[model samples]
Target chain A: MAHVSIPSYWKTLPQRYCLIGMKCKNCGTINFPAREICISCKQKSEFEPKKLSGRGKIYSYTVIAAGSAPPEFSEQEKLAGSFPVAIVELEEGLRICAQITDYEEEDLKIEAEVEAVFRKIYEEDKVIRYGLKFRPVKKRKSLP
Target chain B: MTLQKVAIIGVGQTRFGNIIDKKAEELFAEAFLEAVNDVDKGIDISEIQEVYIGNSGVGGGQLGNFSSLMTDYVGLTGASALRIENACASSGFAMRAAILAVSSGVCDVALAGGEEKMNDTPRNRVRYWLGISGDMEWERLSGMTFAGVFALMAIRHMHEYGTKREHLAMVSVKNHKNGASNPKAHLQRETTLERALASPMIAYPLTLFDCCPISDGASAVIVCKADLAKKYTDTPVYVAGHGGSTDRLSVFQRDDVTSINSSVVAAKRAYKMASVKPEDIDVAEVHDCFTIAEIIAYEDLGFCPKGKGGKLLEEGQTEIGGKIPVNPSGGLKSKGHPVGATGTGQIYEIVNQLRGSVEKKNRQVSGAEIGLTHNTGGSGGTTVVHILKR
Candidate 1:
């Protein structure tokens, strides 16, 4: 397990919970987890916080087997035999990796629509860490 | 200041596998002594002016001041020594440092090596050590292992390029076959394509055989100014070019997860410095931490066109007798990846191959004049490429 200090986790809550990214003023590139400089233009440009739509499609995914989860997620792995994790390309054009929640294996496919949802990431003895996870978007049915 | 040319006169490595009897320093000493003896005219350890040791401190044993400890254990305590850490590419960067030290006229002779005793740690704790290499904030927190990260790449390659599982299996089979001929390899037995395909799944699309074993070993190399290389050995493998680069640590952050951009950038720099194209490479030893990594390497290193790595393997172009033999020392897949030591380990193999000194005739690439090594750190975050020639 990796040690995530309380202060560090607290500092990142905004980006973790609200998907706050840094929009580059020079190149108009949005850097997730935010950055001081623009990644695309490599400029020391001013940046503003941008909230994402929390919607995206799967770019890639993998089913991590039980017991193979990092020491931090051992508890969750025990409850879930095998779970899918994916890299989602958001509608805003930035990418983030997160676990896919509330889905079957068949639902985990490339380009499958998903939306971020608040969920518990992991728990230590003293505190619980909550963040966003992606799940398949429910399809709407047509009415007569 | 004008930079001097550099050459590797000698190289050595311990047989990579579980060996509980020896400590990490002891293994490093063994490799160092072998390297000293490998020098054709013989070398005096006291003549070494500097040393750079690579280690990830996986077991937390001697994490601090590790390079000094390794030098002290080997009886070269007074040399300028430091540890270089870059996850799996630790020693690869160490070698680069040594090359710079000698080429810049900072030292006449320098030693570059790496060591790791991975098997000593408990299995669960080992996971913690490895997990920290990736993005702990997102990837690890989301329950991603090193294998899981590569598996994701494997699946994406399959989806985009129509790479079959068999292409991945072929890499394992070929490396195992080469390793069987190498006495020092960790896994020295070959398996059928059927057996490789049937291996239990560690992560979806990545089976047990797709992964390299946790290994314990050390490797060392002796480098000197090219002008003085003749004093140490008659057949010196010149370090023609070296390059390194880094990218976003997290895989998802990159524009394309299918290929490691660091490798591509590093390889391009190396080729430019060497004044040679990819076609000039007679042989190569690439970072094959996972089967998919090797496929990506073929494309990244310019062995073939992008999205055609699997096809290149299927055509047997990378075999020993083929166009460009790769991993003749069995590679990380079968030779064993002891993390930090892996980089110099590849250097050891290439130096030997270029000198036509490989003990096993079967695994030797005949008439190999130029060789290359590609070592990556933490997926695609850091990469080092070196080109060597006789």
Candidate 2:
């Protein structure tokens, strides 16, 4: 029932699942989801597929109320209520937008350290779409 | 060979709100007729050699070949017609096309207008239609709506510039107050700062009152060669300048999220063409789809320094009685945003403001000779700026 087709979803899997980025060989700039041309250098130079480290911090965020959830996300909203979405600034210096998962409202702050985790994005046409979502980094307890 | 100059001989717009009684054709006809009647000298509809209609086909009703349908409805069936689609800036680009058609000597007279019927669509479908304007694969898939996108900007802006929540509410208060005087406004009632701040949150940092409502409306304007403008109307508003630009579609792709680079580039081109600075503009109709948008427009249009937009509003500088009167027609915030119709609707307001013909005396900017209209498609991905002078 999603607008995206099966092949379209499949095409995005590498970038979606692994946070694969395209680094412009000419200018040393990285583009999220990969691009043939570098945005910074405006060159059609060769691009190398680079895996982005999942560690990042929140740049900006918003809590989508239940009423404003898009139809495609209705099922998710019904199950989870309002959810927080954020622009996560990766350690590689590229900013990517994704839903922030497994965090309390008070904990969602700008510059909050987060790490990408694979999770279910949504299900449509009887196929579940899985992608990366950022969550607050959990601190490990000391072994006493 | 010198290119011809373009002038707007007439402009018209229906009361912007829910009008289920009339279909799209009827709405376009009504605005078209009003524009024709507004011309100082009579003009035959058949003389219109070219027509450019702006429409997003939001409801998916009569999407294909819509330009011909509108012209045929208005009895200009045989004339050349085309539809321009740039999301909310459709009509602004349509007007730009009409100016080019007249200025290039391709046609002596042309029609540019836009119409949309958004109120009748189902809520879920409405969300779907509006969502596609943004990056569907990434932004929408992450549950970002138009409001959510802007909300993100607002949060970042506040973080960097110390803009208070009150600064955002003030936009709604000022625009709603102005809309109260205009008869055509959809939300004609005014709201206080307290109420705007307290309104339910659609997206954080942006309450319900920050967003423009979905409405059904249409608007039209007639453009002709400036040399031949005297034959049609003595008060013809000259199309002093026009500029348009496009940026990266997704917000994440841009280097700066606080400002819209397209608006800045478009406004610069327009100012250069007109040989006029922002201070020369007596009145303006900038895209105020949300409060933060208008604030960003102020900076992008050079009305104030970057990050000073919030202070500009807080100082009452953009009010009707202030140094630069903006959105005196209530803007999209109060006047209503019917998608495709919004761009030309801004033009309609500026034309009337330039002519000193605004129905409400209090809403009129005094001695308004030069005016500007800033129309943006989607979240500033595309923008068109036009300068008008009497």
Candidate 3:
């Protein structure tokens, strides 16, 4: 069995280890973290599940000193040192926000290209919290 | 029908910083005295018909009945008073209330004031209350704070258009440099671009320096109807246009982060109502709760092109001599943001600019005939734009 698990509630585990967004079938607007209604067209019940293109550009990022971040993120980072926070521009024109893992905070450059990776942020008493975070593209390690 | 011309006959404020020991009423009286004193002649409290004040929940204090208390301190024996609040845009709304009251013939003279005694409360609680106006279900659950929301918008601005941190830092450097000149500003110390960028991060892409300090202070402005204006002062600043609008609470709801539509709409309404454009204005005091907000205001207020705000800051285009000098009174970024008092503070700055008394030598824009103020409530949900002419 894989160490990773998506509980019975999900329709399917994310594909390509990617974060999911919804596109308004009515207005063709893609939204991250999903929304039930379309703000532009004022149409609801028209959204369809959509997979996002993980490749994106860095908008802006900053390193928060450990104590300043939300109490939850601060504790989880005790296990993962110096997470990279970024706003990424998807190929589809949607801006997806996520934290970056597997890269040095100082090494990350603004507008640099990157892809997504689904990872566990923090797990509590008995429940596990799973979410998507981004990392810089490895120049030598080609995308699968 | 055109709105009745409203004029600011007097403006005043108390020292802005960490004010905790004082009560709201005491602060209001202090600011009220300053404004009445600035009237050139004198304003009797009895002559002032009404009062509008803004105060965000300080220590969860109930201020619904706070206005009536103001009359006692100001010695307005029988004046009708009311508290007006719209989140951080409280004082801005207070100014609007006073303007409308006089324009509607309800009163010839009115007082608008704002105060926040916030140092007595904890920072976390302040953050909690600040988040009250938005769609808390989605935003708070998602951990999107006011700074986080603006920070995300800053990130989006960078991604879609290439706005740089160095450019954003210019807002802090400029405002702080301006704030340093105003003895009344909360953070009267100048900040360099390097120091601003190196400050500890609050939200991603937003350094502590980029964010305005949590300040405690008060501000007041006395407005009079057109016919009775001469009774107050010879040089009165007329209110040409007043407009307000609201945007979707969620940042996701807005089409573009590069431009603030609410600010645009409010400014549009104000300009059309005033028969003026951004070009005709001499100076402005736009909301700069964060450096990014100021950058966006440059575009939203029509001072510069979209994606050109950062460039404008770098070239000193927003200084006293440029296309339009903004935040000459240090703005929210440097002057201090006492949430409720912030909006009225902008009015104070604009009136001072129109009067040519905005203390700083380098910041004094000479021969200024028109000035404007842009105030936003809770993460752009509500915004008011006012144009004042001398």
Instruction: Quantify all predictions' global Cα lDDT against the true fold.
Output: 0.92, 0.91, 0.78
User: What range of 10 consecutive residues in model 1 chain B has the weakest lDDT sum?
Assistant: B131-140
Instruction: Considering the two chains of model 1, state its CAPRI-style docking category.
Output: high
Per-residue lDDT tens digits for candidate 2, residues A17-46, read 998898899999998867777788988989
Model 1 earns a TM-score of 0.98
> Candidate 2 on B67-167: residue-level lDDT in tens?
98999889999999999999999999999999999899999999999999998898889988897887778888888888999888898889988877899
Q: Residue by residue across B198-241, what tens digits does model 3's lDDT show?
A: 98877778888888988889999999987678887987889999
**On residues A48-95, what C-alpha lDDT tens digit does candidate 3 reach at each position?**
778777888766554544545444444554755445565567787866
Superposed model 2: Cα runs more than 4 Å off: none
Summarize candidate 1's per-residue lDDT along A1-144 as a digit string, tens digits. Answer: 337787888998999999999899888999887777787898998998889999999999999887678888888988987788899999998889999999977788999999999999989765999999999997878787
The digit string of per-residue lDDT tens for model 1 on B1-390 reads: 899999998899999999799999999999999999899899889999999999988968898899888999999989999899999999999999999999999999999999999998988888889878878788877889999999989999999999999999999999999999999999999988999999888888898899999999999999999999999999999999999999889888888889999999999999999999999999999999999999999999999999999999999999899999999999899999999999999999999899888989999999999999999998888999999999
Among residues 3 or more apart in sequence or in different chains, the pairs in candidate 2 whose N, CA or C atoms overlap within 3 Å are none
Better of 1 and 3 by lDDT: 1
